[model samples]
Target: MRQEITSYLSTIKNEMYQLTKFLYDNPEESFKEKKAQDYITKLLLDKGFTVLKNYMDIPTAFHAQIGEGHPKICFICEYDGDIKKGHIYGNNLSTSISITAAISLAKVVSKISGSVIVIGTPGELNGGSKITMCKQGAFEDIDAILISKPHIYNIENPKCPAILPLKIVFEDNLSGNLTSMDAYIMTINLLCQLAKGFKPGCTIENFSISDKVCVISLKAPSFDTAAEIRHQIEILTNTLGELIGLNHEVTLAELPCAEIKTCKTLNRLFAHNLKECGIIELETDKCVTSGSTLGCISNTIPCVNSYISILKDKSIPYPSSEFAKETLSEYAQEIGLKAAQALAFTGLDLMEKQNLIIEAKSELIVQSN
Candidate 1:
């Protein structure tokens, strides 16, 4: 069955590349991905799957489900690329790989039982739609969620640290005499002091966005710690506002403290599939603390965010590099194909191997306990 799946995917490889090219050539911003959504929904619909638009009441989001019955699986696709330009981190490539894998599994659904869902999550550049969907129970019934991201190595199960996104503004103009530069300097000084215990090289630290306004974030081992830090910062901000003769307001967006609790069985399966494709998994490839919307989905369900290295310059990995001009580059195509083939193999395993699914569920239960 695995061989058959591989052979089938080989036949449609060109189609996948074409879709990747189309999305790369025409990029869209978050919540404004009508054309991208149209293409994705049409592909899934053409494959006889049921595609639901306005997912979670978000106009740009979508949920496409195929097959039926138990052991339902999901694929996460960030169809929204970089704002104004084409795919910078090769997100369009990731989307294409995910779409092709889901559709490939759909074609073989008769031989294997279970279901597949391709979730169109937008706003990856901002606070992503995945968080909203997870909060609203979008992944409530999914057994596993698969993600393909760019990296310099192949990671089995990555862990993301607890993070808080915060923004504070000084409103009262009683200090109407205060210039933007003055406000910035004053707020930055207060923020620097308030960022106690959050220093560079520490598990908990302040990652401030340098601008006229004081926008910052706190990362900690747990969400509670992050929240507490935010509270302290707010109190300090209020005190600073009073001293500076300005009123202030602070906004905080807190995420789950839970790590991307990985299912070992699924990770092992993915590693095996990747090795089959000449991709080596190393023990030194440790989980790094990075921020991604995948954090929300993994917190909600058994999900794995695997990174496939596609480094042409050796300096720019998938998360930070722009490939708009390299849409048809050989390096980009290679990465896209590897991502699609590996993910498709894993999807096939999830569908056909009941014992594997049982093992994955057991691992999740044990870890959760």
Candidate 2:
């Protein structure tokens, strides 16, 4: 079965590269991804998917559906790019195009009972389209959601936790003696310490600082930082937020981040299907947990996210273009194909009601515990 998927993927290599290159060449930020949307819709339509353009009112966001009754699954992605960098991450387009591969395999999707919808959500980097989709009564009745990211260690399974994104701003008169560096360190420490309160192993937080230079021009440097807190225990996210006097702010405090609420039934279906795909490989590294990239959809729909090994320089930090390039290697590409093909088979197992439901439930419980 995996071999057949390999062959199927091979035949359309150019299509994959061309689509990737086109998006890479024409970089769009957030909802501005009209071209990317058109390209994605056109391909899905050609392959017999009922493509819905600008799904959920998100300009570049879309949903493509194939197949009939039974279970209704989805493949969703947050595709907001740094227009300034274009394809800085190994022809950048490849990063997004990787999702297209799953789209290209519409035939396999059709084989599964029920519908398989491909959701191309925009503004993941900034806009938070997933938040919008979840709020607008999206993800209702969806059986499972899937995503394939550009990089990470290919985990047969990765831990997933409830994730919450928050923005913290420190506003006070600086006596006119505050630099961006000073502000950065101070904010990082406070945010890091606050995040630490979210229970040790299960919770994780990532932060970014925004410069509100115009507002606090002369008074004080407004160090606006965004932090995302994730935990298997849903209550922990809120408990951590409560621990910090989020309501207390010197200038302006906004709770920009919130963990996604997922559908319980769909989660079990996905877990069962994944286990059947292959022997579930446990990750050795403690930090390596549930797929952060795919977590966007898990918040709303039943989605399973995992990591594919980085092509090179795993030790390096984020925004490492060099490491991103390594992911595009020929060998890496082969591994990706194998992984995708194996995963395709996983979708088939989902057609069987009992096993699929049980597995997903087990996975959710496992992660929660």
Candidate 3:
């Protein structure tokens, strides 16, 4: 079965490459990936998967599926690009890999008693589309979720921190003396001081600031810690406003993202498949974290969000023009194909073995608690 999967993916490598190149050539931003959505859905439809466009009331999102019954494996596809760097984060490669895996798995799903679902989740850069879909129960029936990302090294089970983005507004109502910038600076100082005492690993960044408002992000190892941090920040902001004679408002900038709960059962399966695909040197020592919306889905279902190295040079930082260019290179195409093969292999394993899904779900239950 593995050999058959490999041979089948090898034949469709060109098609996968074409999809990646097309997405690279025409990059689209979050929630505006019309071209990408149309192209991918059309391709999936042509491949005989029953596709539901405009999934969960999101125009750019779609759900494509094949086969039926237990152990329904889901492949998440994120094609939204960065606003400035355009596919610099390798979303094009990730989407292509997901589509390739789903299509390849569909070829053999008839022989098994499982299903394969390809979910087109857009707005990963800004809108948190997956989070919205989770609220809408998009992944209610999924047994396991698999996604691969392009990175500087091949990694398994990277830590993704729970993130909370907020907009803080300071209004000088009494004396009109305290400017918003002053409030922002003061808040930053307080947050820095507070962070020193936080037990859980956390980070706070002020991403955007204007005359009257500043947008800050909080990341923590878990949602409980993140919410605690938010609570502390709110109290501090209110105290500071009172002391400075200013009015303040704190609002959520986006949906709060949950930390990834990687299923050990799934990770082991994916690692075995990755090694079978000739990826021997896996990086598991370094601690890596991402603010991806996929973390939201992983919080509920068993998931494996692995990484495939797209750049040979480790110094080229991600979300840069150079990294974006590397995503279009032949090396990236090869890596993407391998990742797809590994994902499909893992999906096949889950389909053929119900015990694996049961173990993965049990792991998820324990980890999520």
- Best model per lDDT: 3
List model 3 lDDT by residue over 8-63, tens digit each. 88899889989998998888988999999999999999999999999999999999
Candidate 1 lowest-lDDT run of ten = 200-209
Model 3 residue pairs with clashes: none
Backbone clash count, each prediction separately: 1, 13, 0
> Poorest 10 consecutive residues of model 3 by lDDT?
283-292
- How much is 114 displaced in model 2, in angstroms? 1.6
Where's the lowest-lDDT run of ten residues in candidate 2?
214-223
How would the candidate models be sorted by lDDT, starting from the highest? 3, 1, 2
RMSD of each: 3.2, 7.9, 1.6
lDDT tens readout by residue for model 1, 283-367: 3236576666766566446676777666666555345435455545677667667667677788888777777877777876776
Write one digit per residue (lDDT tens) for candidate 2, span 251-332.
2222133322343454344344444434244243224422243444454445655455545556644445444455445655
Candidate 1's C-alpha runs over 4 A off are 173-184, 193-196, 199-213, 253-259, 281-290, 317-327, 365-369
Cα lDDT of candidate 3 equals 0.87
For model 3, the stretches where C-alpha displacement exceeds 4 angstroms are: 174-176
Query: Which of 2 and 3 is ahead in TM-score?
Result: 3
